[model samples]
Target: MAPSVLIVGAGPAGLILAIILRQNGIAVRIIDKEPTYRPGSRGSGIQPRTLELYDILGVLPAIREVGEFVPPMARYEPGKIEPTSTARLGEWVDPTPDVPYSNALSLSQDEHEEILRTHLQTLSCSVELGSELRKFEHFSDRVVAHIFKTDSDGNEVEETTTFGWLVGTDGAHSVVRKQLGLSFLGETRTEQQIALGDIIVEEGVKLNLWHMWSVPPKLIALRSGGATSKKFMFAYTGRPEHIADKTITRDEFIQDFYAITGRHDVKFGPTSWLSNYRPNLRMVDKMRDGRVLIAGDAAHCHSPTGGQGLNSSVQDAANLGWKLALVQKGLAAPALLDSYGEERLRVIAQMLQLTTDLFHKTFASLHSADKSDDSGWKRGGDLAMLGVNYCGSSIIQEEPDAVAGSAYMEAEGGRVQAGYRAPDAPGLIHSGTPTTLFTIFNTASHTVLLFGGDLEAVGKFPQGAVRVVEVLPQGHSVGALAGSALVAEDREGHAYTGYKLQSDGFTVVMVRPDGVVGAVAHDTEGVERYFQKIFI
Candidate 1:
């Protein structure tokens, strides 16, 4: 019998995992507590890495149809006459030679989820709305889920189903997490209450960029909504007493909006959405418990300082979905599931720490006493959408003489070192189109990047075992690299270079389908050894 997987939550994580699993021929059923799509503009940005993942799912164009791309971010100092502006964050650095997504894209969560829902419909599986999970029991063979749901006629019903695995893609207050007795360890910024609303701005007020006002009493951010609606999200921090009434009047919102924009003639309309949210940074020590596991906000909740929450959640789904599918198919051992938590927890820790630093910096900049000569806070350099790396894990191999460098890396004269993502130079083509390494590589599968050596070495292995791509750099051209459209150049004029592999040494870098570096090697011996250790 085909193994069944039960996923709790119909949000981005749950839906994306369901799609990936279903594509792999796994039986998946997704349940959400909400009866229908929540009518509101919650999250409104999709990072570049996530865009690449969406492209893999063949939904990038659909996202772009209703999405808006926010221009380079700008940062201002309190009471300052000038602000620092950049075209993109440091995270937009060059794409790895094997991965394709190099830039960030902006879209509302509602629109993103809607597109995902539509795509799910085309598949054999669908999300069961109003189907709330009440409890579950896990056995050695399968997991039994107790589900409570309401039918179309407003009748409540209960059902019990058994599945091979149960994934909690629910929100921070995930019932699955709660049921597992997992404790969320971190701090919550209770004083930081933000008032957010989506509304129509007055005529002649063009909303094309993400505008922020670094002033006292509040820190406000304004960005354009997607193409479908002439809507905009206005957010600002306020006092608890100010919103104690739990009622944010339109007049109050417009008053603050005008105060920041210095445009008093602007008129406000009925808001499409309004809510107050408090920032919290928390993570569960363990993401998996027996036959149950957690992903997205259910596993870790961080402050939305750098907009990493949504992107990371989707990534969690990508990382867990495939592993679960492989185990279900009997292609991989059950131990492979343990790597999911081990790998993702490390990534989440980095994200939490980075965002927490941003939170402190943003809040500190509100006070003049906290101001320093350091321009680190300005230019928003601290906000790196792509500077994250997942080395030092069970999957990634460390060189005996590995030298630390930047977040990305490059090989010099046949010697590979740790630092930044591997660069994508020229002479690399996929399906006849010249592309960078990342453009051809993604988190969809475990990628075997073979640098140098003849293709015959890879022929020994089965075709499905690995994705083999050769790197041959002709020359370095800034335009050629930029044209690849994976990453933009920094102010330092330092763009990643594509280097040709030398000799028959053959450097094999294995990247997990979720974009994490699993292992690296220099010859077929190490590659074969790694395969034995991981697959067996």
Candidate 2:
């Protein structure tokens, strides 16, 4: 019998989860309360890490076709632009050409979701929009869900299904979270924010960089869309009266825009979508109970300071999706699922802390008086994107040669530590395909990184279960000759640095499907032991 998984919410998290599960041969059914896709530009920036993940999922090109790259820029005040943080777009994709997407692309959330949906449609799994889950009953063996849906004519109907597990990828106000009786414990910032619609900007005003204006009572952000469209997000200190009425006129929006930009000659065009949102820094106490799990905003919601919410959600789905698929197929033990909460919770907590700090810094800049020391503000802004780290989790290994263990010490933790995504190595190859370590390493159920040794000894494992690659000396490694590769030479003359082997023999580092280090062993004898411990 095939195991079935139920996912609530059709947003990015849910949709991406469905695609991954389906790709892994798992049966998935996704439900969403909304009848149709939401319009307008909600989040317009996709980080470099996300682009890397999309490449692994084989959808990077599709996303890039509709997306734009945002050149980094610093804005001290409205219309006052300062040149800062700039990278050759896509350089981070692989640090090598054989890899897919190496750069961050800017596209509206609507376009991103549409591309994901199109990919999902190619699979057997699909999202059931307009269908809302009324309640769920968890049994010892199976979980039953009651779904209430409204038809095209607005007729109500009910349906029921049983599944092996249920995942909540719904937004912050997730009904799935509500039904589970989970406590969302955190503080909601007292400030209110208004993120306006996707509108066209007048010609001659450059829309290539993100325009930020630090003004009292509000910090306004103008984000450029792919090619032509433009959108603005306004974070105001006080809650305006009648904001909940949803009847804000275009004239009022224009006035606010002018006040933020301090430019009266600017004209506003039609808005495609408009909404007021109160930023909340919150996370559920637990991400899983019994056979139920949660992802995305349903489990955690943070300020849009680092633009990490969507990326974090997608990553959560990526982690849980493959595990659920393997468990359903009886390829791994149920204990593997426990690592999900243990691993993701650590990440969520870190993101919350970083985002909270970002909120304070961004808002503080907004409230500061003229000529105030902007050094602190500038440092905070720069650190926002480089502050995420995943350490001290069940899945990541504590490598001896690992760098500082603190989350703040490095962005996303040092690649060699536990709970961290293995860093890319330049000029690595797999199956005659020219690619980086990330491309070869990310294609398996678990990643087995062999530092420096012959591959024959480690080739006994199940095919495709682990990826085996050789990290050669700098001058000898293929990356050196590949011209485009970013391979580095350390004191040992190795093609890479930062990873430590526990022993001289075949050291096997098993990275969980979610990109976390699951277990480590120095010899083949430790394989069964590691498996037994994780299989339950």
Candidate 3:
């Protein structure tokens, strides 16, 4: 099929973009340079915010089935039977009605990719393995990609196709980024090197926890929280000079394992995969070049210290996919695509600084307790990614009432504001069904929420592209409105409290497809004006 979008690199970002675009009735073709899906548990941390996106995308059920909470770390000294130090990986916070997922979970990166692929398959799209994008160029209105695939006799057959848009979800050394003549400026850590792998071990080794040995110049961490078939994820790094940037042999691994753990009964078994490399911190200055764009590692890369790489990339896809869909449907102008870079680049720059800071702090904390804060590590609420917002975006609009007391609109505690993440409120009965804001937020479409608005005003909504929801305040005439088929009762006042709707005027909050509030208006006239800037 001739696709509207040709996505390069079928990793998390590419797969997610494809899935979302396909779900929204846009044709997409996703191609990967890798011959097969990569194995081993690399980039295994799924942040709370990414988990929420997974729920909205209809993949949380599968992800939850295979995912596990981050187990506390048991730090040990060399040749010692007992642990010398202990630090919980992260504190577990109970789920709130507003923030359903409040902590990070671990799933092997490969497992995470598999889950994305599974859902993509359900959308009648699958990754084209062993297919590589060799070259491409953008014309006046479309992008043409040159792809090479192996034929029946192992001969390379080249196919060239044109797409309305081209996206590179490729990696740090993305061909798309290179082709666009963009620069990825960052530094490489020659001081850090490690041999990481997934290996089977004896039953003496326990599961559901981390085994860590942090001694200056050398470190070894073994975690089994999301292990498949009882195989532990092993990362061995010590003495940058001694660490090899290439795969190590079994004998070499065994010697290093014993040297660190000082345990004889727990033996190492067969290895499934091995890789050695020093990570780099890099990001593209711009995420788009006309019709060609990039997301995920193709846009930015950093040390995996804070586990933000994957989550950030998935968000990149989530942000770009819907904008591309809207543009493709002719509902929005192509200029809407420009905001993808502006909004995402700001977050990426912040992430690079955050991850780099954490990378240094993690190494610094090895010898002494962190005096900066009670938490030895910096994996706190910020790391949950719930705080990441696009409040600075050009498309986000807020009226005077929403930001009356502040110099500018800001994210208040669980309050819904323009450009902030739409807060979730439970105990809302819609169509005789009990639901939260998230239930209606599952679709890849604009949602206009009316918190105590006139019932007849629902006819003013932009048809087909928006979901109109009328939320009635508690004890404020509990009856369905003729303007909306989906009317809700805020029985517990969570919606009223979250929206600050005690005022007399109707509070109209427009949420973008990616969950960021697009606009806040006082009435139907304001709603139409806000959407006129959005839909063509």
Candidate 4:
């Protein structure tokens, strides 16, 4: 099939976008520059907000299988490897009725990408490896791109293709970003250089917890790979001038490990991969330009502090996927794509500041004399990214009546309103069958939820674009409402409670495909108007 959407860079963001678009029956061609899959343990933190998206995309179960909760970090005292203090890097939080995924997980980006790739394959789409987007030409109605790929003989071949839209997930040094002339404004921290690598440790090493050696002027942290992972991911940061030669051999790596930890019992083995990196804090001015757009690291780049980079990048793809699919299918106006950047830019800017601040704090803690609670690895609900919202977006319509009850609920002190992350509700019995909010949210399509409203009201909304689901009180009957559009009984009132809908009153809520509340209305009367702003 000829692809309507061309996605460059098959990282987690690009893979997710392709999966969503293909699941919606939109043709997608995803390409990656790297000849093979990325091999690294970087960007391993999976925030809670991202896990919700994975649930919507039908890949949560696989992701959870390869993921694990963050372990506690042991800070060893100077000159003594045995005596030290320990603190939780991130404590596991119990799930609530409103939020099912309450905490983040530690999973390698490579593994996460494989999960997305597998899901995309289920929809009959596969990423093209050894493919790179050379350039793109924007036309009035479509964009044409020239892609470079190698054949079996390793000969370069250039192919031209036309697409309804294009998205760049091509990392910080994005070819599409450069070709579009979008300015990436930010700075690089040269002084905060870090030597990072994945290494296999000897037997009998404690594998569940992270070990940190924060001797003054030098910091080395060995974080757990995952639940079943045998390799530990390590990083070194502080003084780069110490290694003047800058050549790190296996012996040198082991020597440095002992010097930092001051322990002779622990043994370090061969390293799988090694890299010296400096964090780049930068972002493009905007996300869209004419027929071409950008998402993920191509649009924004930040320090890995708080583990926000990978999660934020995938969230960007999730936010953009449904909008592009809607527009391409003519269900939504082309201008509807404008909200993609309007909704995400502010959140990304806020994320940059938060991560940068944490990075500096960690840098300061490593150089400070007083080793208090300044380890800077204190990730909490704030890092979960569940608080991101699009209240300022024009497409998110909030009725005045909805402002009273449901919209006022706090998620980590942040309001859950129209344009905020939609909360999950449990114990919904639809036609005598038990279900939850997540079961029906698997598709990248608008979900219309009617609380105590007639099924006839669903006809007022768009047919193919909106999926109307009714939630009524127990013992209430809506027999054959609009020919079986799915009616649910709030047996435990968990649906009403989780959504914070007012009792004894009817309400209609529309959730965006990306798992955010797009609109809330007291009745179906405003549903048409709310969708008019979204669809053509």
What digit string (tens of lDDT, one per residue) describes model 1 on residues 1-536?
44399999988999999888876678888889889877666776677667766766667778878776555544454344344443343334455533345555677778889999898788777788899998999888889999998988999999988998999998999999999999999987777777887877755334555556655656676666743456778777754465633647677777766666565555666787787777889999988888899999999998776778888888788878878877787767788788788867877887898788877776766665443333323322323344445455454566666543333223345223332234333444444455444445553355666544443445544335356554432342223221121221221111123323343345666655554455667777777766654554
Q: Candidate 3: global Cα-lDDT? A: 0.80
Displacement of residue 209 (Cα, Å) in model 3 is 0.7
Which regions of candidate 4 fall more than 4 Å away from where they truly are? Answer: 78-83, 242-247, 399-416, 455-457, 475-478
CA error at residue 528 for candidate 4, angstroms: 1.4
Stretches of candidate 1 above 4 Å error? 1-3, 64-66, 72-102, 213-215, 226-229, 240-247, 255-262, 369-385, 403-445, 452-465, 469-500, 503-505
Root-mean-square deviation of candidate 4: 2.7
Per-residue lDDT over 115-204 for candidate 4, one digit per residue giving the tens place of the 0 to 100 score: 889888899999899998988899879999999999989999999989988899998899999999999999988777788888887753
Estimate, for each residue in 351-433, the C-alpha lDDT of model 3 and write its tens digit.
89888888887767665544233243547567788878776567777655444221112477556777777777888887667
Candidate 3 weakest ten by summed lDDT = 401-410
Q: How many backbone clashes does candidate 2 have?
A: 8
> On a 0 to 1 TM-score scale, where does candidate 1 land against the true structure?
0.81
TM-score of 4: 0.94
lDDT (Cα atoms) of all candidates against the true structure = 0.66, 0.64, 0.80, 0.80
Q: Which regions of candidate 2 deviate over 4 angstroms?
A: 1-3, 72-104, 230-247, 259-262, 371-390, 397-404, 407-415, 429-432, 442-444, 451-464, 467-507
Best by lDDT: 4
- Per-candidate TM equals 0.81, 0.82, 0.93, 0.94
Stretch of 10 with least lDDT, candidate 4:
403-412
In model 2, the Cα lDDT at residue 446 comes to 64
